[model samples]
Structure formats: structure tokens, C-alpha cells
Target: MRMILMGLGVVGRSFLRTLIEKSPELRLKYGLNPTLVAVADSSSAVQDERGLDPKEILDLKVRKGSLSGHAREVGMRGVELIRGVDAEVLIDVTPSNFKTGEPSLSYIKAALNTGKHVITASKGPFALEMPALIEMFQESGLHLLFSGTVGGGVPFVRFVRKCLIGERVLAIKGVLNGTTNYILTRMEAGLSFESALREAPGTGLR
Candidate 1:
């Protein structure tokens, strides 16, 4: 399977690194070969139709802190990357704009239209446009997966989907936001709200 990563932000870069390190084991378990085809950011991107070197992509991200140094075979806007790439999978890592869902929606819609299965971390598509996106994906015969939205890396979604297959999940609840839990902990443990909020990483409440 070939993949195109549409963002070079902190989470996107980190996920790529993790996948690269564990890809051999993953391939063995899934009985499939996975390849990273393209890496795109707001400013620039690296595209090699054959496949991108995961190590090189990681190194470039480390050195530049974004995908700016790589050669740009396509000069259109970053959003167009999803439409033009030939990869079977498009990973939409663009930051979610809850207000309008501008770029994220545009990218997701374009990828679905182009017949690529999309796995997105963007909140707008899942949180707000889920029903419409579900219909679109079903109509197009593609998948629009948003595993990163609800659990925020807690494995809650996978647990519910895989383990609770037959069980009816009437309602779901969680301390889904790690920042909320941490802040509450600090406050209960006798720390200031300012300090607790400050402790949140560069991504803030996310």
C-alpha cells in the first residue's frame, strides 16, 4: 500500500517516524507491504512517484522542522496534494478549523472524490461533517476513518471497535482530553490553574 501524508506538523511527523520504525512488524502482521509515497506541508513537499525514503523524510523533518527543503515536483497549493497524489491512502493531518473547516474539508472532499481511502486526524470532518462525509465515502466506495479524533491516542476507539464488536455501546464517556485530566490533577493536588494550563505542551489543550 502506498501512502501520502498531507501535513508535516508535530503529530504528523511523529506518526510518520513511529510508522517507519515499526513498519516491518506491521507489514508482517497485516501481510501487506506499506510505502510512504509523498510528504506535503503548507509551504513545500517531497514527491517521488516510486516511493519516498522514510528515513530521508524523517531526517528532512528533523533538520528543517517542516517539509520545506524537499524538491517540489508540484507547485500548486498544499491542499491540492491530496487530489494529485497517486497514493492509495491519503493521511490528512491538517489542523482542524472548527469555525469553517475550510482547508480540511476541501482536502478530505477532494481525496474522496479522487477515489483514495482517507484517514484523517482533522476534527472538522469527524466532529461536524461526519454524516455528510460518511455518505460521501459510501457513495465513492472509499473509507473515511477518524480514529484520532475521539480518543486522542487513548486506544478507546480501537477497544470499542474491535473488542466490543457485538456489544451495544449505548453511551461512551471518557476523560478524553489529557490536558483536562492533568489540569484537574494539578488543581486537586494544590496547583494553580495558570500553572496547570502552562504545563500543557506547545499544542495547548489539544
Candidate 2:
């Protein structure tokens, strides 16, 4: 599947790394070959419909700190990139902006309008405009996935939607933030709050 990935932050970089490492397994086991057609950060983007190198993209981000240095760099905003890319799916790992549902929200809308399925890790759009976004995707006959929004990769939304079935859910309780959960776990292991907070960064929780 051809895809466009937005956001080059920690989550985005880690996701690209994992995709590179697991591509072979993914193809062999699931018959899924994900090819990145474009990748964008806050300030810049790179596009290659034939397929962009995931490793090279990571290297560019690390060495230059932005995708602008790439030879295939494109001059376009996030929404424009979403609409212009000829991709089947859009993986939006952009940062959340609960106050406005940003650029991610706009990017998602453009993808849906252009008939691209969306898989987003950002939560702001869903939190603020779940009804409208859900309606948009449903009407477009495309999938709008957000499994990573609520509880990272735990599939909380999937569990609730599939496992619950007709069962009534009385209440829900859990730590949605991984960093905070890590600190709490450390505290349970007898570390002070401050010490746990200090140790969280080393574990790459955030």
C-alpha cells in the first residue's frame, strides 16, 4: 500500500523504524507491503510516488533535523500534501492539539475527501470532532482508524468495539499516557515520585 506519513517526532520516527524492521515479516505473514510515498514534518516534506526509502528518510531527519534537505522535497502544506499524494492510506502521527485539532484534523479531512483511508495516532481531532469525522469517513466508504490515540498500541478502541458486543460498559479506568504510567509503575517499585519522573526519559516513555 502506498502511504503518506505526517509528523517526524519521536513517535513518527519510531514508527518508521519499526516499519522498516518489520516490513519483511509483514509481507511474508500478512501479505502487506507498505510503501511510503511521502513523509512530512512540521516545516517540510518529501515525495516520491515510486516509493521513498524509509531508512534514508530516517537518516535525513537525524542528520539534517528536517526533510527539507531531501532531494525530493516538495513545497506544500500538510493538507495540500495529503490531497496531492496518490496514496491508498495516510498514517498521521502528528502531535495532538486538543485546543484546535490542527493541521492533523485538516490533513485527515483532505485525505478523506480525496478517498484515502486514514490511520492516525493524534487524539485532538477525535476528541473534538469525533461525530463529524466519523460521519465523513463512513460516508466516504473508507476506514478511519485511531487505535493508537487512546492507549498507544493497546487496541483499547478495538477491544471496546469488538469484545464488548452487546455488553454494557459501566465504567472505564486506566492510564492513557505511557510516560505517566511508567512513572507510576516505578513509584510502585519503591522509587520516589521525583526519581520515577527522572527515570522516565531514559526509558523512552515519552
Candidate 3:
């Protein structure tokens, strides 16, 4: 499977590293050879129609603190990468402002226009721009998966997609924000909300 990633921040980088480390196992287990066809960041973009060396991408990130020096085949902008690459999948991890979807929407649109399945964690795109994106994906017959947007490390998205196939969802209720939940729990337990919030980082709230 050919894939193009849209960002290389902390989460995106970690995802790439994990995928690279797991490729051999994935090939043997699933009879699939997943290739990172391209990568884009705020500073630069790189594309190889055949496939990009994952090790080279990680090395560039380690040396440049970004993907600036990975030998760009296109510019840094998301649209440029989306338009130029011919990958089957597009991974959108650009930082989201939550108010305006901005670059995420553009990148998603471009990929869908080019008939690529999109996997993004940009909440604004799914929350506000979902209708339009859904239409585009349906029209193009491509898939859009936003697992991290709904459940960062949890199984909520996968459960909903897979397990909730033909079942009716009567209701959905749970603590969505872990950070806020931790703080509120501490406040209810006698600790000050401020103190609890301040200690959230150490407890892995983020």
C-alpha cells in the first residue's frame, strides 16, 4: 500500500516510526507492503513516486528537527504535496486550530479530489466540515478515517466503525476529555482544580 503523510510533528513522527518498525511484521502477517510514498511538513515536502525510505525520513527529522532537508520533490504546502503525489492514502496530521480548519480541509479536499483515502486527526475538519468531506469521499469512492480525532489512544473510533456496523446507537456518553476529567475528579475529591490541572502533565493527561 502506498501512503503519503501530511505532517511530521510529535504524533505524526511517532506514527511513522512505529509503522516503519512494524513493516516487516505487517508484510508477513497481512501480506501487505506499506510504503510511505511522501511526507509533508510546515517547512518542506518530499515525494518519491516509487516509495520513500522510512529510515531516511527519520534521519532527516532527527537532523533538521523537521522534514526540511529530506530532498523535497514538492513545496511545503499541504496542497502541493497532495496534488503532486500519487499515493493511495493521505495521512493528515497538521496541527489544528479547532476554530478554522484551514490547511487540513485543503489537504483533505486535494487528496479526495485525487482519489486517495484520507486518515486525519484534525477535529475541526470532521466536526464542522464533515458533510462536505463526506460528499466528496462518497463521490470519489474513497474512505476517510479519523480514528485519532475521536479517540487518541482508546478504541472508541474502531469500536464504533467495526462493532457498531448494523447496530443502532441509542446513546453515547462518556468523559471525552481526559485532562478536564482528571482535574474535575481531583476537585471533587478535595484537591483544588488548579493543582490537579497543574499535575495533569505528569500523569500523562496530554
Candidate 4:
């Protein structure tokens, strides 16, 4: 799939790295080939029709604060980068603001308006504008997938939609914040939440 990625934060970076690591297995097993044509962070955008090098992307992120440090320098923010790319799908893993879903909502709407499929992990747009966004998708016959919205890669949405197709659903509930859960779990085992977060792998709360 030719695609554009809209976020380059920790979650986005981890997704990209995992995609590269599991790509060989993915191609062998599912016949999936995800080529990133463009990527954008908060500051800048970068695009190459031929696809970008994963190593180069990570290296740039490490050396520079954002993807804009790439020599090409597309000079666009999130939504502008969405329009500038020739991608068929957009992956949005930006941070979510439950109060007012500004930029990410706008990004998803613009992508759908341009007839591009969207898969978003950010909770802001989906939670605040689900009715409108779903209506847009249904009317346009396009996809607005949000499997990553609730459980990261747990496929919670897919499981419910596919497994409960004909069943009457009442309610579903589960822990959404892994960090807080981890800290609490450790606290139950006699360590303070802060101590647990400090020792947790890749946790920022420490």
C-alpha cells in the first residue's frame, strides 16, 4: 500500500520500526507491502515517490528533532503534507486531545475529502467526530479504520466487529492506559507507582 504517515512521535516511530522489522514476515505471510511515500511530524514533511529508507528515517529522527530535517524539506505541516502526497491511504498516530480535536480531525477529514482511506490511532477525532466521520466514510464508500484507537495493536475493534456481527452487544470495557496500568500493577506488588514507572521499559513518566 502506498501511504502517508501523519505523526513522527514515539508511537509513530515505534510503529515504523516494527513495520520495517516485520515487513519480511508480512510479505511472506499476508502479501502486504507497505511503502511510505511521505511522513510528517509537527514541524515539517518529507516525500519521495520512490519510498523512503527506514534506516535513514530513524537516523534523521535521532539526529534532528523532526522529519523536516530531511534534505528535501517539503515545507508543509500535517494537513498540507496529506494533500501534497500521492498516497492512497493515511496512517494517523498523532497525540489525541479529548477536549478539542483540531489538527488531527482536520487531517482525517481532509484525507477523506481527498478520497484517501484513513487508519487512525488517535482517539480525538474518532471519539469527538465519529458520527460525522462515519457518515462521510459510508457515503463515500471509503474506509475510516480505527483498530489502533483503543488497544494499540490488539485488534479490539476488529474482533468486536467481526466476531459479534449478529450478536446483541451491551457493553465492553477494558484498561486503556498501559502506563497507568503498569504502574498500578507494580504498586499492588509493594512498589510505588512512581518507582514502577521509573523502572518500566521505555516509559516517559519517569
Each candidate's TM vs. the true structure? 0.85, 0.90, 0.82, 0.87
lDDT of 2 by residue, 73-127 (tens): 9997699888988999999988888899998899899998899999998889998
lDDT of 2: 0.90
Give me the runs in candidate 1 sitting further than 4 Å from their true place: 165-173, 182-191, 201-205
Report the lDDT tens digits of candidate 4 across residue range 1-206.
88898888777788788888998998999998888888887778788899987668877987888776587668667777888788899999887878888688989988987889999878888778889998989999999898877664578888888999999999867765666677788899999867897876554221
Clashing pairs in 3: none
* Candidate number of the best TM-score: 2
Residue 142's C-alpha lDDT in candidate 3? Answer: 92
Better of 1 and 2 by lDDT: 2
Model 4 scores a C-alpha lDDT of 0.81
Which numbered prediction scores highest in lDDT against the true structure?
2
Please report the TM-score between candidate 3 and the true structure: 0.82
**Candidate 1 vs candidate 2, TM-score winner:** 2
Clashes of each: 0, 0, 0, 0
lDDT of each: 0.78, 0.90, 0.79, 0.81
Better of 1 and 3 by lDDT: 3
Can you write out model 3's per-residue Cα lDDT over 147-186, one digit (the tens) per residue?
A: 7776445658889879999999999888777667778888
Clashes of 3: 0
